[model samples]
Target: MKASVKKGLGTTIWLLSMIIILGGALAFALNPSPAKSIFGYRMYEVLSGSMTPALRTGELALVQITPPQDIAVGDIVTYAVSPDGTTVVTHRVVDKTTDSEGQTVFSTKGDAADTVDTNVPAAAVIGVVRGHIPIIGYIIGFVRANFIASLMLIIAAILVVLAVKNLSAGKKKKPANPS
Candidate 1:
Protein backbone atom coordinates (compact mmCIF):
# COMPACT_ATOMS: atom_id res chain seq x y z
CA MET A 1 0.00 0.00 0.00
CA LYS A 2 1.07 3.57 -0.63
CA ALA A 3 2.34 5.60 2.30
CA SER A 4 -0.61 7.96 2.26
CA VAL A 5 -3.11 5.14 1.97
CA LYS A 6 -1.50 3.26 4.82
CA LYS A 7 -1.49 6.37 6.96
CA GLY A 8 -5.14 7.00 6.22
CA LEU A 9 -6.06 3.43 7.08
CA GLY A 10 -4.16 3.64 10.36
CA THR A 11 -5.85 6.91 11.24
CA THR A 12 -9.24 5.46 10.42
CA ILE A 13 -8.64 2.44 12.62
CA TRP A 14 -7.45 4.61 15.50
CA LEU A 15 -10.48 6.88 15.23
CA LEU A 16 -12.84 3.94 15.14
CA SER A 17 -11.26 2.48 18.27
CA MET A 18 -11.53 5.77 20.11
CA ILE A 19 -15.14 6.10 19.09
CA ILE A 20 -15.96 2.67 20.46
CA ILE A 21 -14.10 3.34 23.70
CA LEU A 22 -15.71 6.72 24.26
CA GLY A 23 -19.13 5.48 23.30
CA GLY A 24 -18.86 2.73 25.87
CA ALA A 25 -17.76 5.19 28.50
CA LEU A 26 -20.71 7.40 27.74
CA ALA A 27 -23.17 4.52 27.86
CA PHE A 28 -21.84 3.40 31.21
CA ALA A 29 -22.14 6.88 32.63
CA LEU A 30 -25.66 7.53 31.41
CA ASN A 31 -27.16 4.15 32.18
CA PRO A 32 -28.06 3.37 35.78
CA SER A 33 -28.17 -0.37 35.22
CA PRO A 34 -24.90 -2.18 35.57
CA ALA A 35 -25.35 -4.16 32.40
CA LYS A 36 -27.68 -3.10 29.63
CA SER A 37 -28.11 -5.89 27.13
CA ILE A 38 -27.21 -4.20 23.91
CA PHE A 39 -27.43 -6.56 20.96
CA GLY A 40 -28.04 -9.86 22.85
CA TYR A 41 -25.39 -9.52 25.58
CA ARG A 42 -24.82 -7.22 28.50
CA MET A 43 -21.41 -5.92 29.52
CA TYR A 44 -20.69 -5.76 33.23
CA GLU A 45 -17.72 -4.55 35.21
CA VAL A 46 -16.46 -6.77 37.99
CA LEU A 47 -16.08 -4.60 41.10
CA SER A 48 -14.88 -7.26 43.52
CA GLY A 49 -12.72 -10.38 43.49
CA SER A 50 -15.65 -12.47 44.63
CA MET A 51 -15.63 -14.56 41.49
CA THR A 52 -11.86 -14.67 41.23
CA PRO A 53 -10.18 -17.44 39.22
CA ALA A 54 -13.30 -17.36 37.04
CA LEU A 55 -13.71 -13.57 37.01
CA ARG A 56 -11.67 -10.88 38.67
CA THR A 57 -11.81 -7.21 39.47
CA GLY A 58 -10.83 -5.08 36.44
CA GLU A 59 -12.30 -7.61 34.04
CA LEU A 60 -15.47 -7.25 31.97
CA ALA A 61 -18.10 -9.95 31.73
CA LEU A 62 -20.36 -10.38 28.75
CA VAL A 63 -23.63 -11.89 29.92
CA GLN A 64 -26.60 -13.02 27.92
CA ILE A 65 -30.11 -12.81 29.38
CA THR A 66 -31.45 -16.33 29.66
CA PRO A 67 -34.55 -17.83 31.22
CA PRO A 68 -34.09 -18.67 34.88
CA GLN A 69 -35.15 -22.25 34.25
CA ASP A 70 -32.39 -22.55 31.66
CA ILE A 71 -29.81 -21.45 34.25
CA ALA A 72 -28.49 -24.55 35.92
CA VAL A 73 -26.42 -24.97 39.04
CA GLY A 74 -22.80 -23.79 38.80
CA ASP A 75 -23.48 -21.18 36.11
CA ILE A 76 -22.30 -17.67 36.79
CA VAL A 77 -25.03 -15.05 36.54
CA THR A 78 -25.65 -11.34 37.03
CA TYR A 79 -28.70 -10.44 39.10
CA ALA A 80 -30.38 -7.38 40.53
CA VAL A 81 -30.90 -7.08 44.25
CA SER A 82 -32.43 -3.60 44.19
CA PRO A 83 -36.09 -2.97 43.53
CA ASP A 84 -35.40 -0.72 40.55
CA GLY A 85 -32.97 -3.27 39.11
CA THR A 86 -30.04 -0.90 39.45
CA THR A 87 -27.94 -2.76 41.99
CA VAL A 88 -26.52 -5.96 40.51
CA VAL A 89 -24.52 -8.90 41.74
CA THR A 90 -22.62 -11.49 39.76
CA HIS A 91 -22.16 -14.91 41.32
CA ARG A 92 -22.35 -18.64 40.78
CA VAL A 93 -25.53 -20.64 41.32
CA VAL A 94 -25.01 -23.21 44.05
CA ASP A 95 -28.59 -24.44 44.07
CA LYS A 96 -31.99 -23.88 42.43
CA THR A 97 -35.54 -24.36 43.65
CA THR A 98 -39.02 -22.91 43.65
CA ASP A 99 -40.19 -20.47 46.28
CA SER A 100 -43.32 -20.68 48.48
CA GLU A 101 -45.20 -18.71 45.85
CA GLY A 102 -44.16 -21.23 43.20
CA GLN A 103 -41.61 -18.75 41.85
CA THR A 104 -38.23 -19.89 40.66
CA VAL A 105 -35.39 -18.97 43.00
CA PHE A 106 -31.69 -19.63 43.10
CA SER A 107 -29.03 -19.81 45.73
CA THR A 108 -25.94 -17.98 44.55
CA LYS A 109 -22.53 -17.60 46.06
CA GLY A 110 -19.34 -15.89 45.14
CA ASP A 111 -16.61 -18.36 44.41
CA ALA A 112 -14.28 -16.70 46.90
CA ALA A 113 -16.88 -16.09 49.55
CA ASP A 114 -17.36 -18.19 52.66
CA THR A 115 -21.16 -18.07 52.68
CA VAL A 116 -23.86 -18.44 50.06
CA ASP A 117 -26.33 -15.75 48.93
CA THR A 118 -29.81 -16.85 49.99
CA ASN A 119 -32.68 -17.07 47.54
CA VAL A 120 -32.18 -14.87 44.50
CA PRO A 121 -35.45 -14.61 42.58
CA ALA A 122 -35.46 -15.63 38.97
CA ALA A 123 -36.95 -12.28 38.03
CA ALA A 124 -33.87 -10.59 39.47
CA VAL A 125 -31.56 -12.69 37.32
CA ILE A 126 -30.25 -10.50 34.55
CA GLY A 127 -28.04 -12.78 32.54
CA VAL A 128 -25.60 -15.70 32.36
CA VAL A 129 -21.92 -15.24 31.69
CA ARG A 130 -21.12 -15.71 28.04
CA GLY A 131 -17.56 -14.39 27.91
CA HIS A 132 -15.02 -12.13 29.60
CA ILE A 133 -12.81 -9.22 28.58
CA PRO A 134 -9.90 -8.59 30.90
CA ILE A 135 -8.79 -5.19 32.23
CA ILE A 136 -11.61 -3.22 30.64
CA GLY A 137 -13.58 -3.14 33.88
CA TYR A 138 -10.82 -1.11 35.50
CA ILE A 139 -11.00 1.36 32.67
CA ILE A 140 -14.78 1.52 32.95
CA GLY A 141 -14.64 1.92 36.69
CA PHE A 142 -11.96 4.58 36.41
CA VAL A 143 -13.99 6.44 33.85
CA ARG A 144 -17.17 6.14 35.91
CA ALA A 145 -15.52 7.11 39.16
CA ASN A 146 -13.54 9.93 37.64
CA PHE A 147 -15.54 11.18 34.74
CA ILE A 148 -13.89 14.54 34.00
CA ALA A 149 -10.37 13.33 34.61
CA SER A 150 -10.88 10.26 32.47
CA LEU A 151 -12.45 12.33 29.71
CA MET A 152 -9.56 14.75 29.74
CA LEU A 153 -7.06 11.92 29.67
CA ILE A 154 -8.89 10.20 26.84
CA ILE A 155 -9.09 13.41 24.83
CA ALA A 156 -5.42 14.15 25.47
CA ALA A 157 -4.35 10.67 24.44
CA ILE A 158 -6.39 10.87 21.26
CA LEU A 159 -4.85 14.21 20.43
CA VAL A 160 -1.37 12.86 21.05
CA VAL A 161 -1.95 9.83 18.82
CA LEU A 162 -3.37 11.94 16.01
CA ALA A 163 -0.62 14.51 16.35
CA VAL A 164 2.07 11.85 16.16
CA LYS A 165 0.48 10.28 13.12
CA ASN A 166 0.15 13.63 11.37
CA LEU A 167 3.74 14.51 12.14
CA SER A 168 4.98 11.18 10.79
CA ALA A 169 2.83 11.49 7.72
CA GLY A 170 4.11 15.03 7.04
CA LYS A 171 7.71 13.81 7.31
CA LYS A 172 7.08 11.18 4.62
CA LYS A 173 5.81 13.73 2.09
CA LYS A 174 8.48 15.28 -0.19
CA PRO A 175 8.44 18.50 -2.23
CA ALA A 176 8.27 18.01 -6.03
CA ASN A 177 11.36 19.17 -8.02
CA PRO A 178 10.90 21.34 -11.15
CA SER A 179 12.06 19.63 -14.38
Candidate 2:
Protein backbone atom coordinates (compact mmCIF):
# COMPACT_ATOMS: atom_id res chain seq x y z
CA MET A 1 0.00 0.00 0.00
CA LYS A 2 1.10 3.56 -0.65
CA ALA A 3 2.60 5.28 2.40
CA SER A 4 0.13 8.16 1.89
CA VAL A 5 -2.89 5.82 1.97
CA LYS A 6 -1.49 4.09 5.07
CA LYS A 7 -0.96 7.42 6.75
CA GLY A 8 -4.48 8.60 5.90
CA LEU A 9 -6.03 5.40 7.18
CA GLY A 10 -4.01 5.55 10.38
CA THR A 11 -4.99 9.14 11.04
CA THR A 12 -8.67 8.49 10.38
CA ILE A 13 -8.74 5.52 12.73
CA TRP A 14 -6.97 7.41 15.47
CA LEU A 15 -9.30 10.37 15.11
CA LEU A 16 -12.42 8.19 15.08
CA SER A 17 -11.40 6.50 18.31
CA MET A 18 -10.64 9.78 20.04
CA ILE A 19 -13.96 11.32 19.01
CA ILE A 20 -15.97 8.29 20.12
CA ILE A 21 -14.41 8.23 23.57
CA LEU A 22 -14.36 11.96 24.16
CA GLY A 23 -17.83 12.60 22.77
CA GLY A 24 -19.31 9.74 24.74
CA ALA A 25 -17.67 10.97 27.93
CA LEU A 26 -18.82 14.53 27.39
CA ALA A 27 -22.36 13.38 26.62
CA PHE A 28 -22.45 11.21 29.70
CA ALA A 29 -21.06 13.93 31.94
CA LEU A 30 -23.46 16.81 31.22
CA ASN A 31 -26.70 14.87 31.15
CA PRO A 32 -27.29 13.36 34.57
CA SER A 33 -31.01 12.72 34.78
CA PRO A 34 -32.35 10.06 37.13
CA ALA A 35 -32.73 7.84 34.07
CA LYS A 36 -29.13 8.37 32.95
CA SER A 37 -27.64 7.63 36.39
CA ILE A 38 -29.44 4.30 36.67
CA PHE A 39 -27.78 3.66 33.32
CA GLY A 40 -24.41 4.76 34.87
CA TYR A 41 -24.19 8.45 33.93
CA ARG A 42 -23.01 10.98 36.52
CA MET A 43 -24.39 14.50 35.77
CA TYR A 44 -24.39 17.89 37.54
CA GLU A 45 -26.03 21.27 36.93
CA VAL A 46 -24.53 24.77 37.04
CA LEU A 47 -25.53 27.13 39.82
CA SER A 48 -24.29 30.37 41.47
CA GLY A 49 -21.78 31.00 38.67
CA SER A 50 -19.14 31.40 41.41
CA MET A 51 -16.63 29.40 39.40
CA THR A 52 -16.92 31.95 36.66
CA PRO A 53 -14.48 33.63 34.78
CA ALA A 54 -14.82 29.81 34.61
CA LEU A 55 -18.15 27.86 34.69
CA ARG A 56 -21.31 29.82 33.95
CA THR A 57 -25.10 29.61 33.84
CA GLY A 58 -26.57 26.69 31.87
CA GLU A 59 -23.10 25.27 31.71
CA LEU A 60 -23.58 21.83 33.23
CA ALA A 61 -20.57 19.99 34.62
CA LEU A 62 -19.64 16.33 34.68
CA VAL A 63 -17.88 14.44 37.46
CA GLN A 64 -16.58 11.01 38.24
CA ILE A 65 -18.99 9.32 40.64
CA THR A 66 -17.53 9.10 44.13
CA PRO A 67 -18.25 9.38 47.86
CA PRO A 68 -18.46 12.61 49.86
CA GLN A 69 -15.40 11.95 52.06
CA ASP A 70 -13.38 12.40 48.88
CA ILE A 71 -14.56 16.03 48.77
CA ALA A 72 -12.48 18.95 50.07
CA VAL A 73 -13.58 22.45 51.04
CA GLY A 74 -11.79 23.85 48.03
CA ASP A 75 -12.90 21.19 45.60
CA ILE A 76 -15.86 21.46 43.24
CA VAL A 77 -18.67 19.01 44.01
CA THR A 78 -21.96 18.01 42.42
CA TYR A 79 -24.96 17.02 44.48
CA ALA A 80 -28.74 16.97 44.53
CA VAL A 81 -30.68 20.23 44.39
CA SER A 82 -33.24 18.93 46.84
CA PRO A 83 -33.13 16.11 49.34
CA ASP A 84 -36.24 14.68 47.71
CA GLY A 85 -35.42 15.37 44.11
CA THR A 86 -32.80 14.05 41.69
CA THR A 87 -32.20 17.47 40.15
CA VAL A 88 -28.42 17.72 40.41
CA VAL A 89 -26.55 20.94 41.23
CA THR A 90 -22.82 21.72 40.79
CA HIS A 91 -20.74 24.18 42.84
CA ARG A 92 -17.42 24.73 44.59
CA VAL A 93 -16.97 23.81 48.26
CA VAL A 94 -16.38 26.89 50.37
CA ASP A 95 -17.31 25.52 53.78
CA LYS A 96 -18.06 22.27 55.59
CA THR A 97 -21.09 21.45 57.72
CA THR A 98 -21.33 18.38 59.90
CA ASP A 99 -24.38 16.91 61.56
CA SER A 100 -24.58 15.60 65.13
CA GLU A 101 -24.36 12.13 63.62
CA GLY A 102 -20.78 12.99 62.61
CA GLN A 103 -21.78 13.10 58.96
CA THR A 104 -20.21 15.97 57.02
CA VAL A 105 -22.08 18.40 54.77
CA PHE A 106 -20.48 20.73 52.26
CA SER A 107 -21.30 24.32 51.26
CA THR A 108 -20.58 25.44 47.72
CA LYS A 109 -20.89 28.44 45.36
CA GLY A 110 -20.11 29.62 41.87
CA ASP A 111 -17.42 32.27 41.39
CA ALA A 112 -19.64 34.40 39.16
CA ALA A 113 -22.63 34.18 41.42
CA ASP A 114 -23.56 36.33 44.42
CA THR A 115 -24.46 34.02 47.30
CA VAL A 116 -23.65 30.77 49.04
CA ASP A 117 -25.85 27.75 48.36
CA THR A 118 -27.73 25.66 50.91
CA ASN A 119 -25.81 23.10 52.94
CA VAL A 120 -25.19 19.91 51.00
CA PRO A 121 -25.52 16.73 53.05
CA ALA A 122 -22.68 14.29 52.65
CA ALA A 123 -25.09 11.74 51.26
CA ALA A 124 -26.34 14.33 48.81
CA VAL A 125 -23.11 14.65 46.90
CA ILE A 126 -22.59 12.57 43.77
CA GLY A 127 -18.96 13.36 42.93
CA VAL A 128 -16.24 15.98 42.59
CA VAL A 129 -15.33 17.94 39.46
CA ARG A 130 -11.69 16.97 39.04
CA GLY A 131 -11.41 19.28 36.02
CA HIS A 132 -13.36 21.04 33.27
CA ILE A 133 -12.94 22.14 29.67
CA PRO A 134 -14.78 25.50 29.85
CA ILE A 135 -17.69 26.20 27.46
CA ILE A 136 -17.49 22.66 26.24
CA GLY A 137 -19.90 21.79 29.02
CA TYR A 138 -22.66 23.59 27.11
CA ILE A 139 -22.02 21.47 24.05
CA ILE A 140 -22.54 18.38 26.15
CA GLY A 141 -25.65 19.99 27.56
CA PHE A 142 -26.98 20.52 24.03
CA VAL A 143 -26.42 16.91 23.10
CA ARG A 144 -28.17 15.77 26.24
CA ALA A 145 -31.16 18.02 25.67
CA ASN A 146 -31.40 16.63 22.18
CA PHE A 147 -31.16 12.96 23.16
CA ILE A 148 -28.80 9.99 22.81
CA ALA A 149 -29.09 9.52 19.06
CA SER A 150 -26.12 11.72 18.12
CA LEU A 151 -23.89 9.89 20.53
CA MET A 152 -24.93 6.55 19.10
CA LEU A 153 -24.09 7.84 15.64
CA ILE A 154 -20.57 8.81 16.62
CA ILE A 155 -20.04 5.47 18.34
CA ALA A 156 -21.26 3.66 15.24
CA ALA A 157 -18.96 5.69 13.03
CA ILE A 158 -15.97 4.76 15.14
CA LEU A 159 -16.78 1.09 14.95
CA VAL A 160 -17.28 1.18 11.17
CA VAL A 161 -13.97 2.98 10.59
CA LEU A 162 -12.09 0.51 12.74
CA ALA A 163 -13.55 -2.43 10.87
CA VAL A 164 -12.80 -0.93 7.48
CA LYS A 165 -9.20 -0.26 8.44
CA ASN A 166 -8.69 -3.88 9.50
CA LEU A 167 -10.05 -5.15 6.20
CA SER A 168 -7.88 -2.73 4.21
CA ALA A 169 -4.83 -3.84 6.17
CA GLY A 170 -5.56 -7.48 5.34
CA LYS A 171 -5.86 -6.69 1.63
CA LYS A 172 -2.57 -4.73 1.59
CA LYS A 173 -0.51 -7.81 2.54
CA LYS A 174 -1.45 -10.03 -0.44
CA PRO A 175 1.40 -10.97 -2.83
CA ALA A 176 1.46 -9.82 -6.46
CA ASN A 177 -0.14 -12.26 -9.04
CA PRO A 178 2.19 -15.25 -9.60
CA SER A 179 1.40 -17.08 -12.89
Q: Identify the leading candidate in terms of lDDT.
A: 1
Please identify model 2 stretches exceeding 4 Å from their true place: 1-50, 57-60, 83-85, 147-179
Cα RMSD to native, each candidate? 4.0, 7.4
Model 1 misses residue 19 by how many Å? 4.1
How many steric overlaps does candidate 2 have?
Answer: 8
Candidate 1 Cα misplacement greater than 4 A, ranges: 1-21, 175-179
C-alpha lDDT of candidate 2 relative to the true structure: 0.70
Clashes of each: 0, 8
lDDT of 1 by residue, 35-142 (tens): 566787888889899998999998999999899889999999999988887778999999999988999999999999999987899999998998999998888788
Per-residue error for 115 in candidate 2, Å, reads: 2.4
My TM-score estimates for the predictions, one after another, are 0.82, 0.56
Pairs that clash in candidate 1: none
Lowest-scoring 10 consecutive residues by lDDT in candidate 1? 28-37
